[model samples]
Target: MNLETHEPVAENLGVLEIAALLRELTAALLDIADFDEALTRLVTVAQRTVPGVTWCGFTALRAGEPAGVAASDPRLAELDDLGHGAESPAMSAVHRREMVLSTDLAAEERWPDWTARACALGVRSVVAAPVDIDDHVIGALNLYADAPDALTARRQLTAMLLAEHAGLLLAGVRGREQRTALTNEIDETLLQEGVIGQAIGVIMTQRGCPAPEALQVLRSAALALSIPLREVAERLVVTVSRSRGA
Candidate 1:
């Protein structure tokens, strides 16, 4: 994050205005229940709020590979395909961990082929900002415009701020997902423990075997069946219950 660009976003969007927009975006992002949904909503918000942005999308990388994309319009996803064989402006932003601005795509010297493709789509200007989380660039937010020089300095600064916020929100969503998965794993372990304990008790009562010995029997059965210990315990308990009823 550059301190020079870190000042107020835009004079047109005063402190109060930017603050209100941030609050709204934050609330909406927090309400998202899944990571994929959050990514989609992040670009949607950028397209709606940023001036002269005709389209918005994001390209995420993992282990230096292009992983996935989320765009406001499905057709805009073609931008990510450009990232595969050649270095488009968006991937360059992600790799360099900085913003890449092409005020006029027609004269983009570095990526002439990509510029020609984008021109065919009626895109004349583009601005991409690295979605940095904890100083690591995970993705880039790509904004496109139909007219040249549409993303002015002030607008670019505003887009950068929004991209930063999206990164934070994405990190938070990932954290929540990991925590939930861990909790579910713990719950499953507890349920398996209870089932195995009940099966051990049944074995002890029926065969007068010690608890450890009964547990060993259950483990042997699991190994023989090539199944989980919990499945073996469940089958044993069910069989015992049925025999008692009969």
Candidate 2:
């Protein structure tokens, strides 16, 4: 929230440069449709736009299992190895719903195995921020650098903002998808009702049965055939039309 407070990192661009980069990144985010694609695009953008970010990745809970879903570089595949049981910085950020920064991975002791592995991969520092939307932590964004103390306070703020932006964009995309699905369901229901009503009318005209009796006939045929009433109604309507043509 306090974008103006921290001192700029030496490895990073000036304030105006970062602003322009953020604008371009937002444009890229808007252009993406799939959530997985968006996450991959975001990590790639972060590695390019954020200073000293050698690699980037995101960890999210998918189908109740925690896993790394995206990474900017192939080397960052180490992220995927951090299974749900791994106590890595990304897990910490998502669990705490806050930022987790480590300036010297070699000396880090919180997660010895993770730190050692990252150091072996030439990653000396990292910053992880939780992607939170609607007061819920959905995932974590992680940025890595090969040098010590690379992710300064200013860059951390920028990373946090980027994570928040990603969360908001994801929420918007999901909302639109849900609305579209609901609309499709409603259209299908109305179409089925109309067809079934027409079939009932046909039965009444041909058999001289009341509406209730005609509906019972349709239901009975459906149950005998182990199918839906709508299916029986649809078949009746099609058959009567074909008979008239004959």
Candidate 3:
């Protein structure tokens, strides 16, 4: 909830241009119905505003579970081609609970196997920080440039701030999903309960039984039919009502 005061996002560029792009980014994130589209807009804004970053992207994981991102960056169009369960050296760094940087994979030894793959992909340097919330690591934020000097203290700090914002937005999205699921479950339960109550009433009137006896009849029928109690109740209610009408 830290609303960091946004100064003029553009210092050297014209104020109008900066304002327009900032406004565009804000609109895209707020108005876009697709979460992926919103994150794409966010990545675009980060890359355009930040210096020395040839690539910038965010990874989203589900409910603090271990997940991977098919990160979107113009530099690595092939990233989208990676099949499931693929990993990059940069991703391993975030998984290891540390910020990782490789000045040159050709000579670096930190992520030996991962570095070789990255070098083949034309990435000379990479820096990544973990995306986390409430003390749980969800994913990672990664940046890469062809040059070794692509990282700076200012740019790195900005990247961390952006990752924090990503975490908050992700948490909100997950909360909304949970609320929707609960609402659906409640609706289904109400519908089923009404049907079951109607069936119990039919049994009571037809068999001259007490309420608990009627319920037992329904339970027995459900077991015999090998169906849900609610489904059995619905069928019994329909059958009894139809016979009365006839």
Candidate 4:
């Protein structure tokens, strides 16, 4: 965490610039870090004010995985298979160093792992715009939708308008160690670790399955539903509670 932790940098705001709201968002992006509080704030504004955006989120390339950098939508469950390649469109964009537009996840047909997961979670389409600096792609802005055609040519025009601002912000904010520290909480914070370890033990004892098998069951349900494993855990706990009338 040696890098700057999203302290404010801009002060002069009296003069109103002549540009669209999205353009202004892009301009402000220059001051945000990869995991900065400003980044989350931007998502909030996008969800609240930006048109044609139902869900707004950002993901950064981390050791070839698309890590959830930030998000504004609550429907978006936390992704678990971020580390799995071929299941990550955002990571693929970083590899190709290009943006990806999915007009229809069912019709376009690519990246089964990612698409299947998205479809299971009710994501009909997506637009993944690359976050590049200098020349290398670092991460992506993923806009999910319930329709086939979510973004139009005008939207890209608007997104690119903002991307330029974001690029500068990302380049200035991104660092290996800092990003690592933020992403290192997956195993420890989620799944059979800490609080979850005790829960898994209960499941194993009740279901007569080994700990490994119980864990496998969780992963399988997540894969089947194309949702995060945590969501499955929440459901299991709820189901047991209801059965016991708790």
Could you list the CA RMSD of all candidates, in the order they appear?
9.4, 10.2, 11.2, 17.2
> What is the per-residue lDDT of model 1 for residues 1-246, given as tens digits with 9 covering 90 to 100?
442244454453445645665776798789565777877888888888777889998887766766668888887678755454557877778767788889998888977777777898888999888886433328888999999988876778777778888889888877777787886676455444788989988888878997767777877889999999899888988998898899
lDDT of 4 by residue, 12-123 (tens): 1112331556565656555554455655755665555545666777666555445446777655634223554445656555566666677778876668777877787778
Tell me the lDDT of model 2 at 244: 91
Poorest stretch of ten by lDDT in candidate 1: 1-10
Q: What is the TM-score of each candidate against the true structure?
A: 0.71, 0.66, 0.54, 0.53
Report, for every candidate in turn, its global Cα lDDT versus the true structure. Answer: 0.77, 0.76, 0.61, 0.60
Candidate 2: worst 10 consecutive residues by lDDT? 1-10
Ranking by TM-score: 1, 2, 3, 4
lDDT-wise, the better of 2 and 4 is 2
Q: How accurate is candidate 3 locally (lDDT)?
A: 0.61
Task: List candidate 2 stretches off by more than 4 Å.
Answer: 1-14, 62-64, 80-84, 134-137, 180-246
Evaluation by TM-score, superior candidate among 2 and 4:
2
- Top candidate (TM-score): 1
Give the range of the ten consecutive residues with the poorest summed lDDT in model 4: 1-10
Lowest-scoring 10 consecutive residues by lDDT in candidate 3? 1-10
| Residue range 1-246, candidate 2, lDDT tens digits | 233235555544466866776787778777555567777887888888887789998876644466337888877667634562468888788777788888888789988878877887888998888886433327788999999988877788788778888788766655665676786675455344787888888888989987767776777899899998788888989999999999
> lDDT tens string, model 3, 99-147?
6555565788865655665677777776666666434437666777767
